[model samples]
Target: MDVEFLLKMGRTKGLEGVEIYKVETDSLALTISNDKVKEASASKTFSMGVRGYVGKKVAGVSINDENLNAEVAFEKLSSLIKTSIEDPNWVGFPPPRKGFMNIACRDERIVHADYAEVMKAIKELMEIMKDEAVRNGAERASVVEGMVRLGAQKITVANSEGVHTEDECTVSGIFMVLKTVAGRGESDKSFWIVNRRFDFAELEYLGMNTARLSLMFAGAEKIETGEYDLILTPETFAGILASALIPAFSALNILEGRSPLKDKLESMVLDEKVNILDNPGMPFEIGSRGFDDEGMPTSAKVLVRKGVLKEILHNYYTSARMKLETLGNGFRRNPSSPTTPYPTNFHVQPGESRLEDLQQELKKGLIVYETIGQWMSNPYNGNVKATATHALLVENGEVKGPVKGVLITGNVYEWLGSRLRGIGREVFTSEGVATPGLWVEKVRVAGE
Candidate 1:
């Protein structure tokens, strides 16, 4: 698509400014059921988002038809602008800037491989899982269902203000649900691994772990309801942070009075040892990008340092309205969605304690491996309510048994504050967030 042509057409239509964002994607997916490839599919899609400004009034439209021309897009945008109210804080689109960092965001294997090659890889992964399950003593274990997906995407952003940027990336992921049958009881556990590049060894490791955990969780029992120390795996903690803690740092949420951190800037909000960074330049990370959706160059920044709130995320609109500079966090969930302030790669600096060390140090605790319904947690008030679907009880530095169906309830602020005990040294990255296992001193768990 010719974004320059779109901008020119918008200008000819008497629009003050124009911006166009385009995305092209090609994807292939394979579904596995009962240890066999059940379905395979491929798709290609294109979408364009156009925004036009006339004085203070602005309007936007999304074009999903690849054949749609710039003239038609502007026609739709113009109609919306005619009936739109003027934004009092409207400013022109951002101008082009330099200093874009180079990052490895694509994998050649995924970008160039065909369906047959990908299917072979999935078959190999399935074999690895079966072997690992046998080695771990679950001789009857099998993969019940799963999926492997590979995607390549190209993004382009252009504006009338001489801002133009383009980026391409490849993404691959594997998700599997392993089930083990022992006597008359059955246990099931699922694992997900995603990255900008494909790594066979990484997927193998996840598959083996899932198989082992599935066997261990067989005949799991619920624990008594009480307060206890909690050890959350990296995946578990990342889910909670993404759902309950990250949104509070959005400048738009703060401005709209939907964030509890609205007045907590520069204050200590977490443990003194906790450090959080919004880094979009990390190599091969899923969220790593040279420029944001608004065509602004992205950079690494400290969001929290030594427990103090340092910076809040902002996009062009929110920054301009608040008289601040854009931090390159402006992002859109989809091609048709409006740009908003969002984190790129939310990274929590790892500490020195390993997972085993933390587990041994805990006199009594529960190690949570998986959770559900974390997205239902409240972001505005920092209230967290999640059910622990996969957890193990530890007593006196020893794994007592598996615990399931436990409800974990706590406030994020309180948990990250004095309740935070330790951070694990091994950091895991998935779905744009990088974190390690987090240990909290005391939490309320509702079990039998």
Candidate 2:
């Protein structure tokens, strides 16, 4: 979609401003079962989204039909805006800004990668999983689904105030799941091999790591239910901590009285070592972007520092409504959606201790590698009730056996606050949040 037509028709349509987002994607996916390829497919699609304002109200429209007329879509969007309810929050669109950082977000290698190369990587991953599964005494091994997706998108923003901006990006990733069965015992695990740069080496390890987890957990045992020292692996910590903090830091939630931090600004919410950040400019990171949906330049901000709540995330609208400045976190899932405060690369700072050291310090505990329902509980109150699916029993600084059907229940704030034990130096990035292995003491664990 072009901005010239949007600008010319804005005056006649009673529209004050307009912005457009265009996206195109190509992907190849294959499934494996019984150590063989069961299905394979490829797909490509293009979509367009447009948003604008009429009077003081805003509305949006999106079209997935690549062949649709842009003029018709814009007209439809303008008509919608004319009939839409006035949103007191929709004051206006953000003005164009300068100083947007140019980073290496688009990789030609991934954008131009063909089906043959992706298949080679998938087969290589399967081979690695097969070797690891058998080495761990697995009778059956399967890569349920292996997918490599190449995506490219170009977004353009233009308004009546002469603010125009454009940016394009290419993304690449592989996702897979490995399952193993041995002696009537079965285990399953999944992982993502995603990054701007396509590294075959990283893809190789994704398979082996998932295979090892399934093999180790295939014959899980139970433990006595009791309060115990707990270690959350990086991935688990990332999921829990991100889910808990994301909503709490949203200024929109604070405005709606749903955040625990609504009145806790500048207060101590975590341990002295706890520092959370929202960094949108980190090079090659999954959430890295040049500018947010509102054409605002993205920058890094420390949401929390030394246990004190520092800055609440804000978009242009929320900042304006709250008398604060935008932190370049504005985003919309689609053009038809309203822009809101969203973290680009939210993560907790790593500490000095390693995972092995955290385990060694705990004479008796559980080392949780992953969980099932950590995000099912409420993030606002920090109450955590999660089921650990692949936890390892620890005794005297060593792993005893894999424990299954274990539940860890506690208050997350207390665990990360006064009850904090240790934080591992190793950080894992999952679904945008990067966190280290976290150790908490006296956690309530229910086991059999």
Candidate 3:
């Protein structure tokens, strides 16, 4: 799509300001079921989003047509803008900024990957799962279902304030469910691996670990209801951060009186050992980007320092309303969606203790590797509630056995503050947040 032509057309239409966001994507995906290839497909998609401003009112429209009719799109935007309410604090779009950080977010291997290569990779991954299950003494094992997806996308953003930027990225991911039977008991474990570059090593590790865990959890038992020290694995902690903690840092939420951190800036809110950062400049990670959807340059910033609230995320609108500069966190869910304040590559700084060290130090606790319904946790009040679907009991620094059907409930403020025990040194990224295992004390666990 010709963004320049759209901008020129908007000016001719007498719009004071205009913005165009375009995305072109090509993707290939393969699905496996019953240990057989069930589907293999490829797709190409194009979408254009147009935003126009007239006085203090703004409206936007998104179209999925490859050959977009700009006249129709603009007319629709104009009508919407005319009917919308004006914002007295409405500021024009941001101007372009220079010195966008240099980062490599694309991998040629994934961009050039073929169906044959992807199929071969999945086959190898399945073999690894089967072999690892047998090695772990499983009576029978099978890959019930799986999927592999590869995609490359080009994103372009331009506005009338002389802001224009382009970025390209490649993504590869694999998800699988492995079922293992030991004697009369059966266990099913699911695992996923995603990266900007294709990595067979990571896939191999995921398959082996998942199969072993499935076999070990063949006869999982329930635990007694009691307050226990909890060791949340990296993946588990990342999930909680993405769903519960991070949203509380949005400037939009603060301005609208929806965030708990509204009055806690520059105050200690967590443990002194805890620090968090929003870093979009990290190299080769999935969420890394040089500029956000608003065409503003992105840079690393400290959200929390030594447990003190240092900064809150802001997009163009929220920052402008607050009379502050944009932190480049204004992002859109899609081309058609409005911009919001969101974190890009948000992460907790890793500590020096390893997972093993944390387990040994705790002596007795639950190592939670997976959970269900974590998204149901309340971010507004920091009340966390999730079911531990995959957890193991540790006694005397040794993992005794698998435990399931445990309900974990706690408040994030307390868990990260006084109840915090230790943080693992190894960091892992999952569900867009990077974090290490968190050892929290005296969590309320409900079980049999």
Candidate 4:
């Protein structure tokens, strides 16, 4: 389609400015169950999002039909442009930027790896699970669900501001859940791996780690109710901060008076040892990109340095509204939706303490492997409540037995400031965020 023609039509229709975003994706996925390939699939999707600006009344429309020409898309957008309400803070699209950031998130192997290769990896993972069950004292173990997915996406952004840019990214993901029967009990543990690059060695270790944890969880026990220290494993810790606590950092939430950190800029927000970073230029990290959905160059940034709030992610709209500068965190779930601030390759800087050292630091606590209901956390009040399904009891620097149905409740704001202890050395990435074990002084745990 002729992008120039589309912009000209919008101008002819009296729109002051126009922007177009196009995305194309190709993906392949395979699922395995009971050590056998259950399903294999592949797909491709193409979408275009058009934005028209008539003064402050900006309108966005997206079309998924690849057959539609630029003219048809423009006409459809015209029909809906009337419904757009004038925004209080209306600014024109950005002019062409001088330079681009150096981003290394694409991999040649992942871009070319075939479905047969994924199958081979899945099959090998199954064999490792089988051996884990026998070696770890389980009666039987089977892969409840296993999936490997590879995707390639290219996004192109063009506008009247002479901002024309394109970027390509490839992603690799692994998800596995293992069900094991030990004695008279049954347990399961899941693991996730996602990144731009694939290292089979690391993948294999992580794959076996979940099963090993599940096998250990088969030994059940009960603990007395008390205020004990807490050790959150990388998976649970990352999920909590990435999913529940992230909303606290969103400028939209702050603007709506729904974020606890609304008034916490340049202030101490966490323990002095904690450092948080969100950057799009981290090589091979998930969510790293050269340009955001809003056609802005992304770069490395420090959100928190030594427990003090440093910066907040921003989009063009939020920056203009707040009289600030863009940090290149703009993103829209779809082209039709308004762009907002978001994170990229979010992670916590690890400490020098080893896992054993951190464990020994806690006299009595629970090792939380996984939690449920973390997404429902209230960001405005900083309240966090979740059920620790896969947890282990530790006493006197020793791992006792598994414990389940424990409730972890705390105010994330105050907790990160008061109860938060030291971080571990090893960092694990889940989807986009990378985290290590987080040790807290104590948390309210409901146990028997």
Best by lDDT: 1
- Per-residue lDDT tens digits of candidate 3, residues 1-448? 6889999999998899999888898999999897878999999989988888899998889878644777888888889999999988788788887869887789898899999998888888898898899888888889999888889989899999999899998887778999888884998898876767787887788789888878767678999999999999888888787777889999999988888899899999999999999988666677688888888888888999999999999988898898897569988987967788898788899999999888887767899988998999888978899999999899888899999999999988888999999889988875458888899999999999
Candidate 2 RMSD to the correct structure: 2.4
Which of candidates 1 and 2 reaches a greater lDDT?
1
* Off by more than 4 A, model 4: 66-72, 219-226
Cα lDDT listed for each candidate = 0.88, 0.77, 0.87, 0.80
18: Cα error in model 4, Å: 1.8
lDDT score of model 3?
0.87
Q: By TM-score, is 1 or 2 better?
A: 1
Global Cα lDDT for candidate 4: 0.80
Alpha carbon lDDT at 81, candidate 2: 83
Estimate the TM-score of every prediction: 0.96, 0.92, 0.96, 0.94
How do the residues 1-448 of candidate 1 rate in per-residue lDDT, one tens digit apiece? 6778778888999999988889988999999999999999999989988888898888888888654766777788899999999888788788787889887898888899899898888888888877777787775878899998899999999889999999899887878998887653688889886778888787888887887778778778999999989999998999999999999999999999999899888999889989999999777778898989988888888999999999999988888888987568889877655688888899999999998999998888899999999999999999999999999999888999888999999988888888998999988898889998889988999999
Per-residue lDDT of candidate 4, residues 312-376 (tens digit): 88888778778887557878789667677888878789988887788876688988888998877
- C-alpha root-mean-square deviation, candidate 3: 1.6
lDDT of 2 at 314: 86
Clashes of 1: 0
lDDT of 1 at 26: 95
TM-score for candidate 4, residues paired by index:
0.94
Model 3 clash pairs are none
The model with the greater lDDT, 1 or 4, is 1
